[model samples]
Target: MSVLDQTRVDRPSPRPRRLSWTVSDAAVMIDRGMRHTLRNGDALFMSVFLPIMLLLLFVYVFGGAIDVGTGYINYVVPGIILLCAGFGAATTAVGVTNDMTTGIIDRFRSLPIATWTVVLGHVVASMARNLFATGLVLGIAVAIGFRPTASPLDWVGAIAVVALFILMMTWVSVMFGLIAKTADAASGFTFFILFLPYVSSAFVPTDTMPAALHGFAEHQPITPIIETVRGLLMGTPIGNSWWIALLWCAAILLVVVPISSHLFRSRTRV
Candidate 1:
């Protein structure tokens, strides 16, 4: 064959580039989220002040009479961390709806950024808020004589589980936000998410309640999470509850994350 023919025949196929995401790109999105949260001052209040207020009210008043084997503060502190996360869910819905309503998602889509960046940004913001609130609640717990016998690794693992549970539920809230026809409806998703814990064993031991109530309470999503957390902090046997909590968190995230992203893209058009 001629040299020219061989050269032409051996010409490389143009590679189809696959999209990539980076730490710097995620950081840019996260910083944008931080700025957005700062601009919305109410988010800080909800994330920090409200949880602190509840901690004060519960520990000083009702906490004195309530008994859950651990110190009252210890008993409720984990739940409060979950509450802080629930509060994050409210912020999630509001942020998503506001972005959609204000055409911010459209603006974002016009850029060369990752499509998943929007969800990642909101999730990071929620994680920041929940982490801050969890730290504050732990401070209060320490002040009220809540101590842990568990090792630092155990505590870290517990915190990681709880934080992830919150993130999973926040994505559920984000899902509602994307498909919500009105901002009011979007905000209401958080209300129900918050209420689920109330009906669970968060405040009282499920076995000590009425038979029917106990049965339902023992099986609820929050029960396993609360039991797992309480076990870690108090050195109680976790039994199967830790695995159960993780499974529930995984199930929720698996169902909600992809579905929420799809709904978000389909509805926002940007």
Candidate 2:
């Protein structure tokens, strides 16, 4: 062969461009997640079931006992939304753990796809699920007695806050899933996220708790988020809760995303 022909032959075919591969790979994985979600009736049911049941139980059964100013349903629905977000994000851990345990991550790693796309796909799907589940809970609240008094901008702010919380929790759950040895362990890891609201201003004001518990409840990450959402929806003074909540979400995401990505790489390495 001529020199130019030899040079062309020796120059390996250009590997496929990465950005396009990442997008397509992430899209495929997202579709996989969506299919998993759609086919799993139990998962979908559980996503909304716990939050609705708790909302009903609180509004009718325990609501009469708890003093949250006017209507207890209105007071607790925001927290319920957050709870639903937590539960939804927790499922990502289970899914990721399942993928890991099943060797799917290894298969993906073998492909010419961006490393982050695998986790990104899971994160995007989880965010959609959280939004849908939260919306369903919100609709049910409206059907019952919950009425939010926020303006258009306030609603926007509330949604942005919820989205940030969802993203933060999703990243954290991804880490949990990657680190977990089993699916059950992964699921169990999110128990604290689910229960964090109970110690916050979700059901009742933090002041009602005992002194030490009160301090913790007042200071935990969930309290400010719940308070910020409540204030936005109820037209109450938000104070600095919104800023604090944003910072918490940003910090969690900044810390968790990279760690989770690294853990995923380590756990999936051939």
Candidate 3:
């Protein structure tokens, strides 16, 4: 064979594509998200600060007015935890919206990578941040007067519920991020999510609410999730609240994930 032909034969071929590449790409995006969080320390500071401030204000200012049979702090801590998680997840919308508007997403599209990796990265980072935020709130609650009778397994279950809830919310946030023209608009979508816990059994009992309000509060997604976390922590009978919460989370993911994916594609089309 000629020298040129021998050189061609010695050259390496391109590697075969594998499904596992998605995981690696997602990790890169996840790292990008973590770096963003670290660079903007204000994000972490605000995320933790708001929840802690709320915990203090509610436990001290309004604790006397709310009655939960047990200490009000203990009763409300679970709800506050959910609130913290929601707040963390809301940042995903802002991040996505900023990227969309700033052309970062367009740059990503030009790369040889799976589209879903970017979304997954945002979600994983958001979940990590939320878990940290919730843990901080729980620690503060414990420092005050909150106590729980939950076992190790119950604690695991509570964590799982919160994580799943965050995942569901992150997808919704992604959709809002894609649809929103401004960061403020994208964030506005989370107002209802942040408010939902209050209307539910988070702050006060549903029975204390008026008839129609009570019905609505009892049926809302936040109620079961809050109740499930509260029940798990308090060692109260969870009954079907955990299952109901899981179902709600699953349903939200089922509906919103596709819509978010579609919106992302439509909006990012070059």
Best by TM-score: 2
lDDT of 1 by residue, 104-130 (tens): 777877766665677778778888877
- Candidate 3 residue pairs that clash: none
Task: State which candidate, 1 or 3, has the greater lDDT.
Answer: 3
If scored against the real structure, what TM-score would every candidate get? Answer: 0.86, 0.91, 0.90
For lDDT, candidate 1 versus 2, the one ahead is: 2
For residue 130, model 2's alpha carbon misses the true position, in angstroms, by 0.6
Residues 139-203 of candidate 2 have per-residue lDDT tens digits of 99999989999999999989989988988888899999988989889879767677788999999
Winner on TM-score between 2 and 3 is 2
Evaluated against the true structure, the overall lDDT of model 3 is 0.84
Global lDDT of each candidate: 0.78, 0.85, 0.84
Q: Which stretches in model 2 have alpha-carbon errors above 4 Å?
A: 1-14
Q: Model 3, range 1-270, lDDT digits (tens) per residue?
A: 556654435633456545677677888999998887767665576467788988998999999888779888888899888888887788788888888899788788876678778878888888888888898899889989899989999999999998998898888888888889998898787676678878898888999999999999999999999999999899777788888899999999999999988888887675
- Model 1: weakest 10-residue lDDT segment is 12-21
Candidate 3: count the clashes.
Answer: 0
Q: Quantify how close model 3 is to the true structure by its C-alpha RMSD in Å.
A: 5.3
